[model samples]
Target chain A: MDPVGLSGYLTVGAVLFVCGVICMATKRNAVGVLMGVELVLNGANINFVAFSRHTALGLDGQIASLFVIVLAAAEAAVALAIVLNFYNNHLTIDVDRAVELKG
Target chain B: MSVPELLNHVLHTDLPRSVQIFAPELVLCVTIIALLLVRMLKWHHKFPTSWVALFGTLAAFVGVFAQFMYMKTGGELPQMRELFEFWGLTQAGVGTAGEYFTGLLVHDPFAVFFRLGLVLFLVLVQALTILTGIPDQEDGQDFYTLMIGATIGMMLACGANNLLMLFMAVEMMSVPSYAMVGFLKGRRLSSEAALKYVVYGAGIAGVMVYGVSLLAGVLGTLSIPELGSRFELLMGDQPFSLTNPTAVATALGIMLVVVGLAFKLSLVPFHFWCPDAFEGASAEVGGFLSVASKAAAFALLVRFALAFQGSGEAIQTLCLIFGISLGVVSCLSMTLGNLAAYTQTNLKRLLAYSTIAHAGYMVMAISALMVLLSGSADPVDSAACVEGLMYYIAVYLFMNLTAFAVVAFVRNETYREDIEAYNGLSAGGPMTKLLCFCLLIAFVSLVGLPPMGGFFGKFAIFASALKAGSVHWFLWVVLAIGGLNTVFSLFYYLKVLRAVFILPSADESRTVEIPGFNGAYVALITLPILALGMSWVMGDLTATAHDVAAYLFH
Candidate 1:
């Protein structure tokens, strides 16, 4: 079997990104939406690492992926905390319920 | 080339210079730590955290001001050198323009200008918080910590030179802001706003980072300045076409990245979160998001868009496309923001739409800059484009802040934020009249009236756009749309003013009496808008903005 190439890795990354976007669009649960965000970030992480190995990006891509991981974690923490606050107020984590400020 | 040599050079030479250039951000970091420590040590009983935050912000502002003066004076000022030395900072890279921290960030007049504005804004916001008393003594430390943290993120955004730095800076600015939107704990609206903001922000950020990865992989570089040269090399003599796979990938990546920035700017189709966020958040947070965050995002957008500029025909074509698209987006944002604002009864929501409209005007200036730069126009036209943007941002800081500050003060007095709350405001008392007068100035300036800063800001932007239109006729349409939007915007602003000066009080017994101190605060902020409209002050500011903008082209 041939080794997985850069194109293969990018294909997987693109699929993941598409799935994440679809999930974010369809999910009504706030946490599920946040999970979609995670999937999207991880997809980018895959591309970064694959680029680091296959392209002239070298260490920069790897470093960027590392930073993205840390940032994603930070973002998730904040998102979950906000979701918790929403839950506390509305007694549910459904984003549809957060229509108090709509125009 | 060995490890020891690289380490020695970085440790001794690069580190010190970067630190000196980064003094303001470091001071803010220290202030954040101090706020946390104050809370941890339970010292809030004796000393107020707001004063601590204010002093720290003032110190940061002074540091940035010193840096601005040093750059403006060409670093030959003796007193400035003495001040740097007193702070235990070296003079290395103090007055010079270059990349610092291994080229992850830049120290230039443009960045310093934004830094000065952001830090000064931090000072003003801290003072406003103290006067308005939103985050009481119990929550002062948390509020200041989050506020300062977000500010540091914005400062980083102004200086980011690498794609990674740009992404990090944006997140740093955004995450804390989400928390700030929900700072009014137990308030359903605040929590909902925060939740919506975070979900939308996270999704957009993820998409943006994916675009960054694609661009990095395709171009084989992540440094912003290097992207253009790499693109030139990649395309060589080939014409730009959709059929080319590399061109297709590059366009997709650029569009995705722009989507993220448009979210921050609250341009059309991405502005759904803006009015909701502002209406749900407190007026103070709303003001911060509208002004400071917008300023930082604009700075980042300028840097990011200009990164693709080069002499190559393909690159120029690409930039021209970006310019036209941005012009279209600017038109849509302005028209929609104004048309939507006409029906808003909540004062904060109206300002939100106004914020979106003002953002559109600023983005139009950027569109002109991109178009002019891509064409063979003289360098001065492009510089004027940037100068227009800078002047507009400087004036906008005051206009938006005063408007939101009035909302906050009224909310404090009446516990209401509806336009009806401001009815007969001018007839109440001296203090209420002062508030009414300040709001009138803010709204009139926002409508681009003369003898106010917003007038000059709008004129500079429109003049520059006209210059760009001479290069490309599409910008002419944008300029006309901007004009119509400005005229259309006047009615909504007057609608609010009519409530203040024309309508009788709904409840005459409920007179809105602001304290003398808060009245002075409003007047203090209003003074700059009035003063900037003066010929001499506007002239000096124009020259300063011109200088800063000149450096970008070089």
Candidate 2:
């Protein structure tokens, strides 16, 4: 039987990270960009948890992933609140619409 | 030891001592909680939330002051002396004093000094906010809550020992600032600044966390001190070159972390949000963000940089590359910041660019420190670099707040934000004359003129950079660019003074009225800039800075 190895987990994490970066760069909606941030964080979380399986990392990686999850939640909450406030004033979620403070 | 026994041992032994050492931060946390509870109480309406916040911050300052005195005077308090002996926290030689909260934070001289500076700055900023009346009675709770919350985050950032703590501390500081920038409801520019800040901040933070994960995974630890040894081990017996896969990976991780820190520090290429944020937010909030956040970020950068030290050949090579890169960053930030400030007409936006320029000056100290470290020469040169950085922050706290306080005072009367509005400011009554006089002093000091604290600060940094250049010639270029940027910065700051004193009043009918007491407030903050400039008056701040630098290696 074929077994999934560390390289497979790493490859998946890399793909998730690339996708998240692209999402963040291309998305115009503030909320959509926030979702991209979540994806990026979760990709890192996957790598952390995967590394926890290694003997050297032991439980620290798992503990780090847990911390990442909690932080990501806090970040998302703050981002959403800012987006909601932006929408309340601008009447749109598009980040481009909020451009009063240009150089 | 069994796992349960270890847990029990930590719970009993470490927790109590950690709490004692972290009393100042705990006071801040209690302030936040108490603020919320007070808001819930009906009496909050009668007693202004500003008073509550003022008292809370003062109490925190007292705690920090007590701790600082204890450290400075060899534990004059009996309780502190006992505590230090019991926890093995006393400085036997001059490295890390102790680890607190099980190594999530360190109780070193560097951290303690920075925490003391941050709390002191917070008290001053709160006083400015109250004077400017930016947060009125009705919304004072929300405003003070966020301000205190953000300050707590910054204090933590200065002391963070673990990667997780670093990331969380930065985010905690940033989140509240984003809200504060947008707190002016219905203001279009304010909301825009908040949006820009949050989006850029979140993206940068995500990248930094990914970097942290990669570094931790490869190194098998999140503790900063562990990274140095692990790095030496990972490059064992290999030729010192960037082509090595491990070095490449580690560099990528570090550069990612640098990106996030640079954004916080508002280095160019990442400084787009800074001017806009300052322009949109009130001068008071801008003052807080500029001074508090920058000082804390500088501390974090110093800590992060020092944590990568090792005597191995490969480590030396990596540190050299890192130092050179930071030198380049310092050059770019200073040159770009000064050039950009030349075109800015809005007073707040101009000051924002000036803040970026000063950050460049501060980063020069870091570059020198790094260069000296990588060379593995005399540690005194590197120590002087840190001293210069700390002294700059100390003076900058006064210089910048004075500028912004004047701006806020003028805005209250004239509602004018552009430079042209300052025409004939000297022509106004006694209060306006006093404000103009204060502004002149602040701007002159900012230009690093002799007799102002900024001059000595810049002198210390440039001297350190020259010492570094004597070791590594690339730092010469950093020193040259710093000199050139100082000249460039002088032009624009003088431009403001010209508008205030030389030019005719743009409008004849409008008279800006300032209360007489406000003159005293302006004087109170601005006098320090003048005093710090004179070496004889302030004595040498370098002694205190040396104390901080002694703890850097650990």
Consecutive 10-residue window with the lowest summed lDDT within model 1 chain B: B83-92
RMSD of 1: 1.3
**Candidate 2 chain B weakest ten by summed lDDT:** B87-96
Candidate 1 lDDT at B391 equals: 98
| Residues B1-554 of candidate 2: C-alpha lDDT, one tens digit per residue | 99999898688767776776777777888888777878888557878788888888888887776667567766656756654454344333112267778889887777878888899888988888888889887788889999999999999988889988888888889989989988886777888788888988998888888888778878878888788789899899885776888888788888888888999999987888999999989889999999999988898888888888878888877788888899998999999899999999999999999999999999999888888888896877778888889888989999999999999888888888899989988888898899999999999999998988889889999999999998799999999999999999999999999999999897877667788877789999998888887755567566777777765643
Give the TM-score of each candidate: 0.98, 0.95
Clashing pairs in model 2, backbone N/Cα/C closer than 3 A: B452-B533, B453-B533
lDDT, candidate 1, B1-554, per-residue tens: 99999999899988888998898899999998998899899998899999889989898898988888888887667877876555554346666789999899999999999999999888888889999999999999999999999999999999989999989988999999999999986999999999999999999999999999999988998998888788889999987899988887888888888888899999997999999899989999999989999999999999998888888888888888899999999999999999999999999999999888999999999899889878967888888888999999999999899999999998999999999888888887798899999999999999999999999999999999999998799999999999999999999999999999999989988788999999999999999999888768888898999999999886
Candidate 2's iRMSD: 1.2
Clashes of each: 0, 2
